[model samples]
Target chain A: MATFIGMPAFPEASARAVGDAQLRHNLRKATHTIRARRAAVVAEQPDWAGLRAAGAAIKDRTLRHLDVYLERLESAVTAAGGHVHWAEDAAEADRIVVDLVRATGETEVVKVKSMATQEIDLNAALAAAGIRAYETDLAELIVQLGDDLPSHILVPAIHRNRAEIREIFSGRMASWGRPAPEGLTDDPRALAEAARLHLRERFLRAKVGISGANFAVAETGTLVVLESEGNGRMCVTLPETLISVVGIEKIVPTWRDLEVFLQLLPRSSTGERMNPYTSMWTGATEGQEFHLVLVDNGRTSVLADRVGRQALRCIRCSACLNVCPVYERAGGHAYGSVYPGPIGAILTPQLRGLTGPLEESLPYASTLCGACYDVCPVAINIPEVLLDLRAKVVAGDHRAERLAMGAARRVLDHPKWLALAQRSVGRLRRWTPRHLPGPLSAWSDTREVPVPPRESFRDWWARRAGEEGGR
Target chain B: MSSRDRILARVRAALADVPRTETPEDVEVPRAYDRSRSGPDVVELLIDRLVDYRAVVREVTDVVAAVADALARRGAHRVAAPAGVPAAWLGGVQAVRDDPALSAADLDALDGVVTGCAVAVAETGTIVLDCAEDQGRRALTLIPDYHLCVVRRDRIVRTVPEALTRLDPSRPQTWISGPSATSDIELDRVEGVHGPRTLEVLITPAL
Candidate 1:
């Protein structure tokens, strides 16, 4: 249940990630494979671009009028025999879930892998309250057992290779519930079998199931979870009491709107035309008690910013992460949030605010490559948002940077000042070192310092024009 | 103000720059994605997609023998089927009729479950169960190690929207494309994680 507070800045963390050969190898292999598959399936659709446009439009429409749709969803969920609770922040959301679980007098709960729950650190919250929440998704189970944070959105343990997973399962399975079979191997199927045996007992006996929604239909009051494993089915169906904590932005206007997202999300994230299973339930079932927690948790502030609110439209597809070059090199850990990569580059800053060094550095974690925007099912224009956040960072704090930029702006805005500065640099070109020292060493460490080009382009142009005129 | 009202106020305040008169419909969504391209060939596409997902698909003239044979092949002797399903469907197999009173352990002990689906989507090879009479409770299909689903050919739809129209929004729905699977470990797809490890689909003929 920890937050990404006090994390080291992006440069420091990414420096280490860039050095880890194994991490880089795993990331490159996984992202490139998924990226190629996504490109192939997305190409199969004749109207993928249209669908992407519509997905963005629908999300924009919903976000602008979220108050109305959320109200509609709450009423609809209530009419369907469910309770709706509103939380302004993470602590309140966690409290509401803990109390709901406590009311059922249940000490254990099964969880579907949910980014919202992860964002709020719900499992850790539950653990502190003397309740153990078992993660049933194979990736999440690996993350939980290994006592690690989820690095990827869809495959949380994307950083772990099969051999490492075998070790994790073999070493950690018994303490949880069932033990891994003798001599468990690194084969994917065998590992999956070991997890299945371990989590089956917990899923069957658990009275409470906790989850997050991919989309919450305001019209039908249905929450949809698209997943690859049957863990979602087991948790959502078998539990007597189900509690789902979803972000306020997850609401869509109607069931028909799902057609647009269903087409866009699967092809973008898992690179499948459709995932293995999609579970949709309108509020509670006949026998199960249902509770829907709508969490604001800085969402209201996010919605307030007209330019930055587009991050809210994300379906948690992780396509942006797969296509991002920086994400490939730096891996998911550098962004220092539950969300990492291109979306996180813009999102974590806005959600947490650029108040800390780590949060501020996140905005610069991108090269503004626009690859994320190209593949985004919702067309978030991540580069647009990144540049916008960078402007905010520049406008705020950083006295040295502000002064330096001001001096540069003065020279660039005036022709004479710029010429004088360029000539001075040209005259000193012979004295210039190939590398710089002190704080500027970071810039010149891996790059050759330019020799001021002998003369500024402006002087060369003027001289050539004069010579031509004389001739 | 309470968190609800405060949150709503914040939302309104956040959108201060947005004109107050704008409605959700003001943002026009281009619905030009090909929803009309589906046809009868979608059925074959459905079978191909299901096969790609590695589900055992049997186009059988005799439903009973096909289901029984598939169950036998999976070594599932004590199978479970919804009471509403025709008794003849599992004619020669040892069938445990679905009971709401059965616990998870009770259902887990069974070798597999056989049930009819409400509808199947051709485009995605998805079989949707809406907790219908024949479909039984969700646990019937989920808890067991193997699931032998009977999808009638006529009940197959060309697209997801068509399947959504056939379903009752009130009933809980599980849209299963294949057996339970995961791409969690280094993005390699592995079947049989949580739900039925093996999904055997019996497509009854159009007649």
Candidate 2:
């Protein structure tokens, strides 16, 4: 599987991101715009809190009886003329997809914007096996053409402006399929037209389509995809064979449950009461073959965690990303995973396990300000999970920090020792240096070291008490 | 064990701490959302919402004139309609009747598609097509650059829940809010993507 191998730890990548003036500008502009819009639409729903609670409850019920639901879903899909496959991990899922595409004797497949495919690096896997996957979503197309990693969940090319998109479309479209028309301007509509013409041919001719579902209804065996561009509609409908890789946690118990998500997702993600399009198909359509791959790629492990399991309720709305101050400054690439922002901080470590420096740094990537919790449509308590992961991290490694914390705990445990230490520090205030050496310097790297006061509060209190006694 | 059995086993083990006897019905889901309100209020709200998405909405007594005017305004010369659509609905505009065997390229060659919708949501201004006889296939509304859908005001529901109850889950459904749009470019909504560039919905009086 293609992984975020050899990626730098969060701090290093974030430091570089903070220095990129253009990236910071783009992140601020895009995030702020979506944030305000989300707030407005959310305020319109008088029972938003009730809806969120219900959404969370529905997911919890599905997950608690996941095994039973999976069986029911498999049978439901089978009855609907769709084949269901189970994948233990990314490798298995990729193998299933490649084999399915190979069976059709097709070398190229068009894809909708799917986080699952990105997680498994399915396109790269297909490429290794001599198959090409074309991303048809407008933002995804920009990312694929630019040979860049997706920086945002909803809008992958959020970091790029209109001018950059035009350049990418102009320079890259020819190599893929249709070339951009000459004199293509940076206007968004013009760029969209160029893409529509370019991908329309691919959509019309492609034999296979690959996608990820926003919600998969177990009762009806229906897969639902919510998108703006008709690209998703084209990919799913116009193809001869369709393969969907869905996370196990995406299942909702009944078709009626779509009411909660259909309400929460658009408002929280795109700030629209309803997105431009939502396509729901039970299984195989009349002319198309269908395959459903239920992927457990680290999701089963995510489910095993008690406190951490709530992360499974995430609908991938990216509301947390829009409200994250850390994400705004550090940018998405700094997270080193397809999943980024507040959700990524807790989710990545749990899914991939905290074995690497990148995963380890992810837990500490948040200020725990709880803004992510406020905007989450599912109401996933991101800060609670972040702190839980942090405790796990602290329990495992960071011997130096642990030792330092232990020493501070000793002083804090004894009031007399703390007062004595404070008095000595007060006496040395005049001679204290502004900068420190060693690991403590990491703290002062971007901040000034505070100066110690001339007198201890304890001494001042004692002196005042003696004066009162004398009087 | 097979991957399927292994995954199920894993899921079972993961939830070992929770009682296995608990059923999905035991969980309480609050449906406090407003699913009430109907009549003229719902139809007006649908129009207001559709206008917000830049969809050209019109209230008309004569569907034929409305459809004809929509095609004329867009200078659409070649239009398509499903065979089941009432001929009187497309009285003035000449429409190429859709057949099941119509290739995607054939549909793409047309200027626009006009049809009736299965249902319309008043709160969200969404028109859902269930591939019914009049609505034709999913590609009919998608491949064309222009889409003119005639929605009966009686089909307009107050909320998403109300609309869901009116439709069936077994059939393939396409929910359209406006013309194809994308917020991909700096989160700024640019309408007209791969779907129809222009969406004109003619609202007929409640039956």
Candidate 3:
């Protein structure tokens, strides 16, 4: 619902980001630590490949018949005493959630760290409606307190170091609800304690909770959420009413499919044998009202493209982000979306449909190093989708590139034309400029032009043959 | 048409490539991953994994004595126990029972909670609670700062898949590994967050 409107394209944003020494240092340290942790845990599973394949296959099967699986999920959830709402887009989804919270007569709601809510900008929507939504996850809290946007999916404030976090907490925590303790330190443990004290009162008093699911089962009508802190548990459990906004692509056909994802996700996302907490609920627990909103916001369109549709198989592990060299240096903000990195390069363009310069440039954010594909738990071939998006961008725009390509194709089609052009270039080699004129100079700015030889290879070969015959 | 119908129609139109006759089972999902593990030392393995997550674990022959000793060591005076938990396990502490079902504020006021888990997984060193009578509601074990769970040796399974077979999907479940932790700050692990900061488990011999 909230677009990254007027944000500079990836190159411009990343150009500025690369010059920030503190930002680069923070990104390098965080990503390298997570990458090594993921590698170690992944190696422990001898059948990790099998599990990854199964995870991909399950998602594919569900996506192919998404209509059917969604129908089943709706019916099952209804039977289990939960209400389901269908949203055609972000505006519709936000309207549904705000209406639900309004019906409950609550002005404040506690939140779990959910990407779907972020994608739709739910908190901003609620704020506009005069309701406050508090983010409970540590990283999310840090981002919120600093008045900053999330950079990474798992750790939204990955760009901020411990000292900066301390500054944000000590300076901003009071305005939110609870103030920081007297003289808070930069040590992580102390920072966590301050958050615990601040949010504990809200958790005890909050009447409503909002979340996004890691996996939703069609067969059993279950929703699964994985997290490290007890904040997720408090939000989902202690509240009187719970609302979960989930993407339709998150559905799995059977309950047993969690075995594959519950293994692959933790190892891939946090590099843990298992995260500290995982909560599963079929429907409304005793004394709690439940609502499930199935959002088709830009997902059905993503499902339409055959090559681009694999992006739907993503579980939002952020493994691809951590392993991306381009992401490491350029940082997450440059991509200009709630989602970033290699996955974002392909996903954001498809979700938003190459709407502007920002969307068009996202597909070129990667170096096609294939590290993202190798680390992807669901095994989304990100580079393949990226190349597909790039081709589409070129076909849709770039008039000069199209003209140059057309001319090259015509010359390549005819041998005489190509040879004549080659000889003319060889004769005028000394007059060649190091950089091209006009818009073409953008390509040559960071590269050198090769000097042409005096003669063509074909002419040299023909002369040798004639001299041998003469001898 | 309703938004649901329109969205579903859009989905159907988008999936025009999928043959109409095709069923969900037409796609093959290869599940060759290890489903079950076998060995005699599963209890020992559970202890090793639980300790790896920084949970204090003890293999005790006497459940009652161990539970009491753990509470005493932590100096937990206002300990809470579910109605179904055996009274013998709480002899030494000021055992508060959830007979009327304590409120969130009430649970937060207590020092700790002791409950019996439904199942345990050795590979991940995780414990699951189904909110049965003995385990109480989700908030009982959550609101307090310290949690001491009793895991009978027989309930321990070798792998995650094996553990799933023994539980009911209909019941709300919470799977906990070690204490609450976060790696969000500079990607360094700092244990003890909103959940029980201290997790102590007593693995007793099966009845």
RMSD per model, one decimal:
1.8, 1.8, 2.3
Candidates arranged by lDDT, highest first: 3, 2, 1
Tens-place lDDT per residue, model 3, B7-126, is 999999999999999999998899989898566599998999899999999999988889889998998989889999988888878988998989888999999999999999998889
DockQ of candidates 1 onward, in order? Answer: 0.81, 0.83, 0.84
Highest DockQ: give the candidate number: 3
Evaluate residue B32 in candidate 2 and report its C-alpha lDDT on the 0 to 100 scale.
Answer: 68
Better of 1 and 2 by DockQ: 2
Model 1 Cα shift for residue B172 (angstroms): 0.6
Residue B193, candidate 1: C-alpha displacement in angstroms = 0.5
Pairs of residues clashing in candidate 1:
A1-A121, A304-B14
Off by over 4 Å in 2: A1-3, A430-448, A456-471, B37-40
DockQ of 1: 0.81
For candidate 1, write residues B1-207 as lDDT tens digits: 788998888998988877888988897888777765645586688889899999999788899888878877888899888878889987888888876456778788999888999999898889999988898988888888888899888998887767777888788888898888889888888888888889989889864
If ranked by DockQ, best first, what sequence of candidates would result?
Answer: 3, 2, 1
For every model shown, the clashing-pair count is 2, 0, 0
Per-residue accuracy of model 2 over A1-471 as CA lDDT, tens digit each: 335668899999999999999999999999999999999999988779989988998998888888888998898898899999999999999999999999999999999999999999999999999999999999999999999989888988998999999999999999998999999999888898899889888888889999999999989999999999999999899999999999999999898999889999999999999999999998888568999999998988989999999999999999999999999999999999999999999999999999899999998899999999999988899999988988888789877577778999999899999899999999998887777778766556656888888878888899999999999
List native contact recovery per candidate, as a fraction of 1: 0.84, 0.85, 0.77
